[model samples]
Every structure is written in C-alpha cells, then in structure tokens.
Target: MQEPIQNRKIIHVDMDAFYASVEQMDNPELRGKPVAVGGGENRGVVSAASYEARKFGVRSAISGYLAKKNCPDLIFVRPRFERYREISAKIHKIFYDYTDLVEPLSLDEAYLDVTVNKKGNPSATLIAQEIRKRIFDEVGLTASAGISMNKFVAKVASDFNKPNGQKTVNPDEIIDFLEVLPIRKFYGVGKVTTDKMYHLGIFTGKDLKEKSLEFLVKHFGKSGAFYYNVVRGIHNSAVKSERIAKSVGAEHTFDENLTSEVFMMERLESIAATLERRLKKHKIAGKTVTLKIKYSDFTVQTRSKTLIYFIADKSLILDTAKELLYQEKMKDSVRLLGLSLGNLNTEVKKTIVVQLKFDF
Candidate 1:
C-alpha cells in the first residue's frame, strides 16, 4: 500500500559555487583564491563566483565591472559547460545508486525521493550523508543536502548549511521551522513579492500564516493559495524524473547601451541566431515569440506575438523579434535584448505518485 503524502522523504542537493568550484578544482593555482567564471573587468556578466569572492559580495548576474570593483583580486575564467555537465552526470549516477526518483532542477542542483530507496535505507538523513560523500569521492566536488518531508522545505533547508554540509528538518519540526523563517527566505518569494508581503505587514512565515486565504488571494491572486498551503506544510509536489522545457531563449547585454533602433536590430539578429541554435539542439519549436528589452535604467519591457504554426528558424525568429522591437517606442536607451520562443511543440503532463511512508 502507498503511504500518505505527508510521510514522503525528499532530499535537495546543491553544489556550492559550481562553475567557479569546477574551475578551481581543475586548476590548482585557482584554489583558495577569489575566482569568478564568465566575466571580465570591462564587460560581460559573472556566471558564478567562488566562496572566497562571495565574501566580498561578488555573485552571479552582476556585471563583471562591478564584481572587480567589489573584489579587485578576483580572477575571471571562461565557462566550460561541457565539463560541468560531465561532472553533473557523475554526481547524478551516485544519486541513482540510492533512488530512481531524481528530479534535477539544474546542472548544479536536484531533488531526490528516497522514501523507498534502492539501498533500502530507512533514514533519509543517513542516505543524504552517504550520497554527498560518494559525490565527493567520485566527482571531486562538494555538495550540500537538505532532508525533509517535501521538496519545498527540503530545498530551503539545503541552504542552511553550505559548502559540504547537510541539514534535516524532521517532520515534527516543520511547522516551527517555517514559522520562524524570514518571508524573504521562502522559495518563490522574489524581490517584488517580498516587497508586496512587507507592505501587507508580513515579515515572517508566522505573519504570513495569520493572513486569511481570501486576503492573500485578493492581493496575490492564484499564488495566495500556494502560500496558504506551503506555510501550513502542505506542499505535495512529487519528484519527477523528467521535466519539460517551456521555452528556448538567448539574450545579450551590449558593451554600450544603444539608443538607435538600427543598432538594436543589428544586435537582435545575433541573439535570434543563438536562440535558433538552442531550439534546433533541443528539437524545440514554438508558436509564440517574445522580445525582452532591458533599459539602461534597469526597467524591463516585453512584447510577444503568437502564430498559428510553430517555428525554429533564425530568419523567422529574428523577423518576429524585429516586429516586436519596432512595435513599441523606446522608453530609454537599451542595455540588453532577449528573444524567446514559447507555446512550445512539447507538452507537459504531470503524473503524481504517492509514496510509501512508514513510521521510523
């Protein structure tokens, strides 16, 4: 018989400073130094930063210019996605030795369900420890894990202990743990949502729990129901082995912000070609094309159009992006441009599986 959803065992494993760590591991000279991957002093963006660099507030998504400004000794290295994927596959193999229900969120993190694992381990905590050890032994990379009853709480706990550590939020402690958690630390609560929650006087999970579902729904729409359930330890999302891609996209941040439409159109051509290559690599096609415009002032605007048929060609993608670009007037000088294809040819049909949850 299947166990109740509440008794499920979930583990969230996250690699620390994955790209930068990989670079450091391969090149001994980079060890113990402030290293950043995929950026430089003059331009580009930092894709990842070593823990050493993070001490100085260097992080991903920030401009390389700012990263250097933060840590002058930070070393910049190019990204090697293929090597990362190879290491990721090896780490995943270690996960499968314990359980088949591995849901990878990215190349650096994944969620594993080990309630009824292949190793027949009864304690999820021990299983997480063994898995981390095996990953380090086999892949030469350190990973952190969070063990709990569900994916949401597990993912949050994984961040509690960083750089080769683990945290287990037992079933009984779930409520108290979440109640004390800052509202900003809750997964899915980004800057905009946090600001909205603060405006409503919701600073912690306890404050959020006090709000009625109707009040949250009135302010947050459908997400209010989500918050209502998760705060009460009611997230039942299962770990699926396969996840479908919703869109294929590519974006570029210019070295200099362009004010002219002609310059912007020229940039869009390259971005569309890059998007096309990604679509073809994944064999993905979509009927909807979206153009993302990021202004020099950091404001973002998007324009989208849908077609009767799907397309993956660069010409078609560029034409649609060009149309969307000219469809709107310039709000400010454009710093970044992005193009994405959605309404994909692929389908997403989720199958929920209730697991075997026996008392330990």
Candidate 2:
C-alpha cells in the first residue's frame, strides 16, 4: 500500500518569458516596451516575446512576419543563447541549494521535490518565496512559483499567477482547484486528447474522474490510465534525478543563410565549444557526435560519427562536427546548424545483473 498524497510537498518554478526577460534585465530600454527576441525579417521566427508584445498576439515559434503583422511596434532582436545559458546555470544552482531533487523541464522551468529539503524548512510555501526572491535579487529576473502536494497540481498552481508571482494550493484546496480547472489544463492533455475528451463530455477534472479506467483505456489507449489516475489526484511519479542524458547538443539559426564552408565551420566551432562546456559541467562524455543541418528551403538532415572512446574535448567535438558537415553534399544554403555528443557511459552493477530467478 502507498501513503496518501496529502503529505507530499512539491514546487514548480517557471521563469516568465525567459529570453525576453533577460533582454529587458540587460537593457533598460527594452523594459515596459513591446520586445521580441529573434529575426526582424520575414523569414525569422520569434524565439521569445515580452508580455507587452504577447498582448498583441505575438508568440514564440510564430514567424517574424506574422508577429510584425500582429504588432507592428514589436521590436525584434537576435537571441543571445550564451547569456540565456549563463542565467540558466545560475538559476539551476539556486534550485540545488534548496534540494538536489530538482528536475529541470527546460532552461526556464523545473519541478522540485521539497518534502525533505536541505534548508530544514518546514513549509514549502516559504521555500518557494525564497527561491522567487533569490532569482529576482541575484539573477535580476522574475519567476512564478507553484506549491502543491504533487507534481501535477504544483505545475498547474505555478501558472495560476502570472509574471513575478507565487501561488500555493494546500491539501484541503486541491479538490476544489481540480474541480474548477478545465480538462485541457492537465499536463499530458494536448489538443488531440482535449478534443477526444470533449467528445466524451469530459470537460473538467470532475467529469474525467466520473469515467471508469476501463472505459477511458478503451477509447484513449495507454494515456487513458494516466488520465484516470491524474483526475483522482493519484500520481506516483517521483522527482527523478539520475536520468542518463542520451545526448548533449547545441544549435543556432543563422541570421542569414550561409553557403560558404568557412562561415559554417566558424559556427560549428562555437557550437562545439558550447557542447563541450555542458558536457564538462555535467561530468559526462560521449562517444558519438552528430551534426544536424537545416537548409534554406526548410529541409533538415543529420550526419553522425562514432568514436572508440568517450570524448568531451572542444577540439575533438569541433573536428567531428566539421567532418560530418562536409561529408554531406550541399543541396541548398544552410539556415541552421547543430552539433550533439551522445552514447554516454553507464554504470554496471554486478549484483543487479546476477539476480536469481525461480520458475514456478
């Protein structure tokens, strides 16, 4: 039997418009103005946009041309990935300082298991407040935090407040919160699932919980099990830490398409350097190097090389990337390039491997 979820304490922290916030923090001119990070031309996409720009319906991944059409006053600028990475590192350090059981969903968001934290803190709410304050004071950025008894609820609570805010949902309030929340707010419920739920009259968590697990499974496949459990506030997933990274990669979309090998090599060197830094930071090495290329026409392809031993050196990474890049014949000018290191080392446990089994 498992313990009830009323005892757990989890927190989800999400940085508000991460890239755009960083831009605003670095340049006072961008503050309180409509700003976006990406290309200004028709061909580019918005990587991140300020809340001011979002009001005009600008969004990340939307084409720069479309963004301009939505908000003519939107200011577009290229992404500063190096700076973002630096800020991410600082925020990550803060999370670790609270609890080692921090699972990063991205550079800007993370789920933390604070049931038993390092600071000897009794209340998860206080810890969240401290984290939010530290991020603003130390990193010059604002973040929203959510505190709950489980990961699912914590994530949802975090978004209840907008930029530079924190929200806590105590165990007693969980039921009421879930009852009123739309079904679409469930973590794994994307467009397709939400549509399916709508067809089934499952518009809210209460509606979802009314259905049988068998009935949900019959219609929704494997994810139906997740829906059944989540609606009832029964999630057993722990904050996992020892997940082996399958690959380490760095990519950049060029401001202008480059057909010259010399320019491509220069970009590759930078990517390799970034990858090497990440690998070292994680104390990881890889034996395989993969290069990804995107053409101006939007077609993409990848080439990879495998080595005998794990390597994390900058020179080795760049060499492999260069070799992989030239190995493929160019079909068009390249618009984006990426490099990745993979095939990490895994620990072997003799006792686990030697487990005895008896057939009945």
Among the numbered candidates, top TM-score falls to 1
Q: Candidate 1 regions off by >4 Å?
A: 1-4, 352-354
- Strongest candidate by lDDT: 1
In model 2, the worst 10-residue window by lDDT is 351-360
* Candidate 2 local lDDT, 49-160, one digit each (tens): 9999999999997789889999988988789999999999999999999888887888899988877778978788999999999999999999999988778888988988
TM-score of each: 0.94, 0.72
TM-score of 1: 0.94
lDDT of 1 at 130: 92
Show the colliding residue pairs in model 1: none
For model 1, where is the 10-residue window of minimal lDDT? 1-10
Per-residue lDDT of candidate 1, residues 172-256 (tens digit): 8888999999999999999999999999999999999999999999999999988988888888888888878888899988889
lDDT against the true structure, each candidate: 0.90, 0.85
